[model samples]
Target chain A: MNIILVGLNHKTAPVEIREKFSFPEASIGTFLTQLVTSPLISEGLILSTCNRVEIYAITENAPECFDYLSRFIYENQKYHDNISFDQLTRHLYFYSSTDAVSHIFRVSSSLDSMVVGETQISGQIKEAFDYAMINKATGVILNKLFKKAISVAKRIRSQTKISENSVSVSYAAVGLAKKIFGDLTGKTVLLVGAGEMAELAARNLVNNGVKNVLVTNRNYQRAVELAREFNGISVKFDEIGVELAEADIVICSTGAPYYVINSDMVENAVGRRKNRPIFLVDISVPRNIDPKINTLGNVFLYDIDDLQAVVEANLKERQKEAEKAELIIAEEVETMDRWLKSLNVVPTIIAIREKVEAIRKSEVDKTISKWQRELSEEEVGAIENLSQNIINKILHFPLSALKAEAHLSGGSEVIETTRKLFDLAEEKQPSQDPEAPPAGTAESPEEPISRSRDSRENQ
Target chain B: MEILLYKLPLLFYFAGTVVYLLFFSIKKDSLSNIALGVTGIGFLFHTFILILRTVESGHLPLSNLSGALSFFSWGMILTYLVLEYWYRIHILGSFILPLAFLSLLSAAAFPNEIRSLQPDLNSSWFGIHTTLTVLGAVAFTIAFVAGMMYLIQEKLLKSKRFNRLYYKLPSLDLLDHLNQWSISVGFPLLTLGILAGALWAGDVWGAYWVWDPQRIFTSVTWLFYLGMIHGRLTVGWRGRKAAYLAIIGFMGVVFTFFIVNLLVEGPHRFI
Candidate 1:
């Protein structure tokens, strides 16, 4: 069996095309059920997010699987009239076998994300896998592939510093506030304007557990609307000084050509604050708060450029850490590849062991029956145990050599040679009984080996 | 055996200092915990030595340079551990543990032979004065470390170039707060120590005020910290200015504690 992935990410396709292929969460179950109906696809999953749409599958025929999936996506979106098959194929990128496994690993690890080290893509992939599992659209191969991918992503997150620091402007603003106040639990935030940037900063702060939000804008109705969204209070823009005194943090983002908050106003507010520190975030283009306010006691004012500088610094740090994360992913991919190859030799090893055991059992029975003197059951048992130990010791070296060679490149050649030398294939068919275990029984040593081989031949 | 016990603290502290410096260079946070554990063990051994010395001499062992340095190093480690527990600033150990180690190593350079307590140093006031003064010096040492951190962080912020070291260092606000706290706590203890010394002087030397260089310089150091505290409270002096004052005040502490004892001959020269 082979692993295959066909999808278009932010790098390959524009948002317009990506959106056309996205599967809504409510419809993903039905979509996955429809996808695995083809005989080529044994298991499947679909990851749909704003930045990318991916389909991961375990299949017998990788080329046919790729064609069917791309056609499926094109038709499911009802785009036959708007786009041609060749155009849709141009937008989709396909990977087969180990490359497909590596692609999913990088995607779940966020190394393939548009943001490089984003955390949201891992969760989205997990949700997609869980949905596939619930709909019975996934089986053994896809299950192991996703589990390994998730663990690789987890290792990358913990062992590297890629996701430790904030890399966004709004997050940096919140980080500065945390450094100043230590804890923002009961602090009040006063929003000076209703701009998008100011709302984003307020939202970040609120998420950090700042419960009291005071909104003040030139437009009173907009202020009330913004305040109502956060379940906060609305104040007048004219009363900025009063609110500034009451707030531990003030977010200023207005379109005023001049400074909305000057040094003198901050000086007075600082006096009233009784030495408590205040954080001021000025996210305006023309600069709403005076830069001189930073020099005042008990007041920390950061302008847009300063916030951007912090974000840039953090991004550089993450980039340095990404190099290390890549090394870790490379090692994990090698390990997973070795494990997948090692699965191929299990049936041969078990077949050889069973063949040797059968020969030893028949020879021991003939020796016991042909003995001249009538021997006791204990003497026969000792002879049988002695013969079994010799057979095991004789088979140990070749068995270990075969298992070791299975992990190297061109390992299937060794397995084929061993099967032919032992004539194990002819022996395997005649020994099969109606009462024997199923093909992929968990208790049997040859289950996954035979199952995987059957799927490969079925292609 | 006693000499070996005295030297063991120096060895442990040196090891801790090496580990801490390695941590600083490598940016590995786990090394900091190992450094803290090593330093804590060194501190326990130093405490054991002090207790042994005090039991052997029938007095607090603050009468010689070796005793004073050991006690001073112990006080600094105690203060550092407390601050580390409260602030959770692991990187501070990288800067402070070497000072602690060097102090103990210097103490080892002096003879470990216990001398008889001098007559003038036998008073209860002598013990109180020396112990309190050493604690005050430890606080100033902490302030010095925090001040150094503040300056580095300030430089990074001003230049807008943040390296790995910049992230490892504590924030400016936290460093400044530590500086202020150390000064606020150190100043009062130092003032009381000086008052106790004056009373002890009057009893031993038949003079409440003396023109001895040690006496004069201790008073100078006391007055400087007093001015710092007054400025901080009244004029809202903080951040860069406060950091500078804390650093300068530690210099005063070192001068009064070490230089005066060695160079200046006065009634307080029992060591």
Candidate 2:
């Protein structure tokens, strides 16, 4: 069988095209059920997220499976009249076997994400795999492939610093606060304005374990509204200096024309607070906090430009780490590719031998039953032995060739050609044997293709 | 056998220091653990050497400069291991192990031949004094390392330069806390050590007070740590000011340990 992937991502399609193809989370089970019912696909999984939608499937013919899956994706979304099949095909990309395995690994590791080192994509991929598993849409091949992809993603996360730094402005501010305060457990944060950025920073701080939040704005009603959202108390804007003396962290994003927090004001606050360190993040267009405040001892101040600079610098660091992640993904892909090739080779070899052996046994029985006179038991045994010897002699060279080809690179093509020469494809319809145990799971060299009902039921 | 024990630890300590430095640059988890394991082995060998020396001399191994230096290195490693276990500060080894390795290296320069203790100089006070003083020095060394870490982390935050080291180093708050813990603990041990030395002096020289350079320098080092402890407790001096005091107080310790022993003549120099 062949493993194939067909999908369109943010790079290949715009948000409009991507959203059109996204499967609703609740209906994913129905979608996967319908997907695996197709004659071309034996095993299947669908990863549907806002940025991309991808389908991974196993089939006997890669070309036919890719066509069937792409068309299926189009039919699922045919209600959208704005786009046609031509437009979708222009955006869709396809990969088979090793390339397909490598693509899934990259996608799972977030190396192919819109934000290169994002942490959400791996979790999303895991959810999709779990959903497919619960829906009974994934057999051994897709199951093994998806499990390996998840592990590779986890390995990359631990081995490299890809997800170490914050990429957003609010998160960068929180990161700086952590570096200064060590732990935010009992620290107090003062929100100095009603700007959206300040609210985001405040929310991030609360999530990080900051216990008390003080919200103050020139418009007292807005301050009360924001404070209630944080489960904190509201203070008048005039009392900011008093709050600053008590606050370990302050986020200022007011739309004032001049500096709201001056050097003299911070200097006074520093003395009142016993020279304890305080962090200030001013994320306003027109500067709200005095730049001169940073020069004072035990005061840390970051304006909008500084926070953005931190975010950009962190993004660059993640890009550097992404190169290392790619190396890890490449090594894992090679390992998975080798196992897939072995799985293909072993099953085909078994199927071809079983086909020829069945033919030999039936022919010998027919000749015996057609006899006009009764034969001795020794005569019957001699005829069976003669047929078995002929079958072994004729099968030795081809079976030996198949076993030898299993050891070479790109050996699956040779195995496929051998299967076709013996007409082995039509013998075992993949979905017809719904109770057949998955092949090559144990990876035992001796009993590679043997299956029992117990094994299938256990799976 | 004693010589073999002494020399084996030097190589192990050198290896440990190299690995720690490599871990500092690479920031790999496995490398740090390997470094810790190497350093722990070195500490074991060092403990054996000190025990053997004490057995041969029939007293604590603090009578000569070589023995004193070896004991100091052993104490530093012990303190480092304890702090590492408690704080999980893996990078602290990168700063602390080099000093330990250098102490052992310099100890090799002094004569290590064991001699019977002098009757006039020998007393139970000698052992107590030396042990307390060396333990105090170990604490100061840790304080010094923590101070340096605090300054670097502080500078990175103030300048907004989030480099690799910036991410690797712990927060200023943690480094400051380490500084406080070390200095506060070191001050009392140092005071007791000085008191024990005076008691030993009274029994040996018939005078509790001495004008010797070693005595004067030890008192000076003791005063430096006293100021550090007093400043932190009363005035709430912390962060940058506290880190500066820890660094400066440790310099006083180094002067008392090295300068008085080598250049200045004193009764305490028994090598």
Candidate 3:
């Protein structure tokens, strides 16, 4: 079987078109069920997020599978009259076999994310795979593929510094606060204005477990509105001093022409706070908080430019780490590619073993029935074991050669010639048993092939 | 065998220093962990060397220059290990382990031959005095390290460079807090140590107060640290200014421990 992926991501399609093709989480199971109903797709999974819509499948024929899946997508969506199927096809990207595996690996490892090192895609892919497995839409190929993808993502996450720092302004603010306070739990955040940036910082602080959020604006109504949205309390503008004294962190993003928080106010607040450190984030254009306050003991002031600098620096660091992550992905893809190619030889090996074993059993039965004297059960069992062992020993070298050749560039032709020479395709129906031993099963006659596969996986 | 044990720790410390320096330059976090492991093993060997010397010489092994240097390095490592454990800041090891290795390396440069204890150094009060003094000096060394980190972090934040080292170093608040705590804990122990040393001096030379250069320098170091603690407590002098004073006080400690003993030829020259 071949692995295939067809999708349109943020790079290929705008949000308008991507959203139109996204599969809802609740309907994914039904959608997958409908997808695998086609004989072309043996196993299937659908990954639909705000940024992309992708379908991954295992199929016997790549072109047939791609055609069916694309048609399925086209027919399922209510297209605009001005839009044509050709235009839609232009937006879709297709990868087959090894490229398909690499695409999925990169996507799952967050390398293909809109934000290069973002972590959300890995979880989304895992959820999609789980949904497919629950709906019985996946089998051995997809199971192994997804397992390897998730593990590759985990390895990249741990072995590299890809996700070490925040690359956004609000998150960088919270990160700096955490650096100062160690933990944000039970800490108080004071929002000096009801501007969007201040609210965003407050929201991020709340998400990081800051206990109390106090908002203050020149207009009380706006402060109350912002406070209610964050489940916080609103204070009058005159009470900024008291709030600043009580707050461990202060986010200022007002549109005032002058510094709203002067040195005297902050100095008084610092004295009242018993010299506990205060983190002041002034994310305003003209700078809302006085720069002189940074000179005060136990006070740290960062303006809008400073936070943006942190974000930029963190993004650069992440870019460097992304380089390492790409290297890891490349190595992992090579290993997975080897394993996938080796899978092509598995059916041939199983078919040849069955053919030989069948011949041995039939010959042994004929020999036993024609015996002159009645043989005991032990003697009959010994003969059966002897014939089985002889068949296994004779088949070992050819199976090893086929397994070793599977990883080479032209190895599939060799496998095809062997199958034709032995007439192995005639016995393919028996070899298609769902209850047949899996590729890595211990009891199979192709044990060495499976063992080498296992070793590759461990690496 | 004892000599080999002492030399073995020097090699371990050197290895740890190299690993920690690599961690600093390359930003590989696992190298810091390896550095910690190597340092921990080296600390074990250091402790064994001290114990063996103490038992073999029937003294606390704080008489000569090598012994004093080894004791001082041991105290620094012990304090650093506790702080590293409590703070869980592996990067600090990149700063501290090298200092520790250098101390031990310098000690190894001196003769480590065990000698019989001088009769004047046989009193238990002498051991207590020297141990407390070394512990106090170690605390100041910790403060020095934390202060240096604070200054570096402060400069990074002030200039808004935010380079690779800026990411690897600890926060300014944490470094300042450590500096303050080391001074607070080290001051009282140093006071007691000075008193004990004064008493030992009176017993040895019939003078409770000596105007020797080492004594004066140590007293000056103590007073500087006291000023730092007082400033932090009363006037809220912290951050950059406080960090500068801590660094200066550590310089005083080095002058008192090394210069006054080796160059000035004071009454405390046994160290």
Give the best candidate by lDDT: 2
Candidate 2 deviant stretches above 4 angstroms: A78-81, A352-459, B1-5, B22-41, B86-88, B202-207
Interface RMSD of candidate number 2: 1.0
Q: Predictions ranked by DockQ, top down?
A: 2, 3, 1
User: What interface RMSD does candidate 1 have?
Assistant: 3.5
TM-score of every candidate's chain A:
0.78, 0.82, 0.79
In Å, residue A456's CA in model 1 sits off its true spot by 28
Best by TM-score: 2
True contacts reproduced, candidate 2: 0.61
Backbone collision tally, model 2? 0
TM-score of chain A of 2: 0.82
Q: State the lDDT of candidate 3 residue by residue for B1-271, as single tens digits.
A: 7567778888988898899889888866678889899999999998988898888887778877888889988888888789889887777787888888888888888777776656764666788898889888888888888899888877766666778888887777788889899888889889999999988888877889978788888888888888888888887777777888889999999888887888887667764
Local distance difference test, each candidate? 0.80, 0.84, 0.81
Per residue, candidate 1 scores C-alpha lDDT tens digits across A1-459 of 556777777777777777777888889899999998977778999888888777888764555567788888787664546777666667777776566777888898888887767899889888988999999999877888888888889999998887877888988878777666656788899999999988998999999989899999899999999999989999988889877888989999999999999998888887776556778999998999988877775677788888988888888878878888888877877787777667657877888888888899889989998983788888988998899899889888889999888787656566767878887663323224433322212122332221221222222
Model 3: residue A233 alpha-carbon error in angstroms: 4.4
* Candidate no. 2 TM-score: 0.86
